[model samples]
Target: MMRLWSIKRVLLAALMLALVQSAGAAKPAAAETLTIGLIPELNVFKQMERFRPLGAYLSRETGVEIRFTILSRYGNLVESFQRDGMDGAFFGSFTGALAIEQLGVVPLARPVNLDGESTYHGVIYARKDSGIRDFADMRDKKFAFVEKATTAGYVYPLAYLRENGVESLDNHFAEYFFAGSHDATIYAVLDGKADLGASKNSVFDWVRAADPRVDAEIEVLALSGNVPSNGLCVRPDLDPGIRERLKQVLLRLHESAEGRKVLERFNALRFIETSVADYAPVYAWAERAGIDLKHYDYENR
Candidate 1:
């Protein structure tokens, strides 16, 4: 009886040791969360809804929590990146370049339109009844611009105007206002609050789709030269594993039905890899227009 009891004790101790080892092996690594910053492309509420699905999808695929942050001003977005407040971001072409230049953010991917193209145009628009027929007609009239940092909204349009002999808004337009968003700029023109407004072609299309009457209410006065579409970017110092996973998921977002839905919400057909070279024209245009990109005050109302 004593021998049998000794054997049982040995077996019980071995089993406990094995269980302890198993628990240690099965323990999960610490959870990580990645915060992504976004500039206001739509109204605050709609912009949140637009990116929520993508953030969830990224979190699920990367096994890390993903958070979406929206900034009211473009300068704030750049500042966030500089301060390590964002792990990644979606930025407009000019702003993306700025982030790259200022923060060393790595350009990752950009969305392709439904037509399978990645380039988009900026548009100067006026109400159909406003008698603003073209860029020249904008002279001596009040103008609306989305934001100074926006490539399509401010840079490209200003470049076009300057190229055509309008030296400065102060000298040409009666006055100008920064509407702070594409939708606001459009609304300003449609409501006769401004004689002309500038925004990206995609934003104009989205507004028209949401409110069909916009097509008849507003007319395109001029189109800026083609510019690279918005792109995803990551901090240069991001974890290699997380960065790889993010790149894979974004590049493949359109392959799965669930991912496709998210893309559609952003008016994107698919996401494709892009490089810094793709945005060279944006820099060129800014220089040509004499816009001081490095020191430009985006927060100035």
Candidate 2:
């Protein structure tokens, strides 16, 4: 009888081991990871740090890992996007319009800033004592630009200059160079480095609020029409379920306590859904600047 009991115990142990192995084999894998790029807009470090919390929050809420890659320059976004194997990006207004046209990326959502403003405009500014009062005064003056792939930094200045009877930057300005960022562009003019410069008003306001010299030493030359703020856009071929999941997560962020914390960090009131029509003004600006979005090349030159 004791011998039979030992045999029964051995059988039970073997059976339990098999059951555990079977359960392990049936367990599901962890969620997929998605890497997204942040367009070059503000100070790169600040921008990256600002979005880290949001990324973590989104990852937790969606059950998928979300990673942010900070772009250091406003280069050919689409080319760099794909080459770096990014799943999508938080595209700037101009880059968003380009991605929609070129890559068919779907616009997901955009933020309404703390001021309850969902849009921003370009400001052409000059140092108070630089004597650049109007378009004609820009002649022979050094200019600072954020980049060509930017609406506020390039399109507005181009359109504004052309409308004022200046056809090109080639011979009109004494010197011009891409300042790489709006913040840098503003400082370039403020520090007497550039006679004229352009930046999105939102950034200008943010910078001005921090520096006394911005209000004391800078004067506005022109303001572009309102353009949609930076927005989240996803790859056209992304998983439909994941895409919809992200959109819903952002669109409904205002209703949750955790989500509110994320919004507060961004200095945003809430996020709103986006549509193709939102980019019309951007295309119009590009057209006025004589740029065809479908074939325009700002990547190299």
Candidate 3:
């Protein structure tokens, strides 16, 4: 009888402890992990290599475990942020605006380029032999854009065309194709498959360096006025203290020696503060282009 009682008592104790542990596990965590989502224009390995330094710097500075995440497409990044998997993101102006308007995110800062310019031009180019001289010449030519989500590719180019009285792809281009990324768009233009293409001037410069012949064959038919490039943003409900710290670290990145070195690695001049108000023109452009910026769905066409 005594032995049975002892075993029963031990079993009851174990069961009670397990119930208490389960209750404790149900509580929220003390510290939340910071998750960052990046674009996947380049190869996955190359993308990770480019942002690894920033990840390390963030970890060292904030004592937080910073993770570098990349989605197959910029659209996926925006979708994931909406689903609450991503805490912060670096996005093009269009996607950033969508994230803000769609997912309750907010623009935090933007990196100035090596020229100390926070903006870059959107260029529309055509093959040298295509006889496309300017925006008017793009009528009825087969065209390609970098990505639907890229401002340089879709937003700015479409806005420029609309402002110039070229309203829709069906009205202007013989057909339109999305090349999935700026690099791919350049390649399409260089191969003569696309009579016209739109992308950031910086991307064109990178392509020129890689292939001298592309520079010879490709000619810019039109260029949009300068606009801000990629922006770093955060979720709407991110803690104020953490948000302020991130902003401070980014804004001062070019001021300190270590931070400057990191910026050099990223080919950035410096970081500057910005707000949703800064992207007002982008929103207006979207409105003019008939894009419902708030209801952007990544999965569907």
Error of 3 at 5 (Å): 21
Residue pairs with backbone overlap in model 3: none
> In lDDT terms, how accurate is model 2?
0.89
- Local error of candidate 1 at residue 9 (angstroms): 36
Residue 146 of candidate 3: its Cα lDDT?
A: 68
Clash count, one per candidate: 0, 0, 0
Candidate 1 C-alpha lDDT tens digits along 193-282:
998889998888888888876887888878877778888899999998888888899999989999989898777888889898988888
Tens-place lDDT per residue, model 2, 1-301, is 9999999999999999999999988999868999988877888887987798889989998888999988876655666777787888988899889888888889899999867889999999998898878877889999999998999999899999988888779799999989889999999998889989999998898899999999999999899999999999988889999999998999999899988999988868889999889999999999999998888787625
My TM-score estimates for the predictions, one after another, are 0.87, 0.89, 0.83
Rate residue 37 of model 2 by lDDT. 86
Worst lDDT run of 10 residues, candidate 2, spans 72-81
lDDT of 3 by residue, 1-301 (tens): 9999999999999999999999999997765578988876555776687688877887777666678788788787887885757779988777888888878787888888876788777788889999988776888889888677777787778877888888567867788888877878888988888998898887777678889977789888777666677878988888888888788888888878999888987778888998888777677767766688877554423
Which runs of model 1 end up more than 4 angstroms from their true locations?
A: 1-29
Question: Residue 122's C-alpha lDDT in candidate 3?
Answer: 79
Predicted structure with the largest TM-score when compared to the true one = 2
Q: TM-score of predicted model 1?
A: 0.87
| Model 1 residue 127 lDDT score | 80
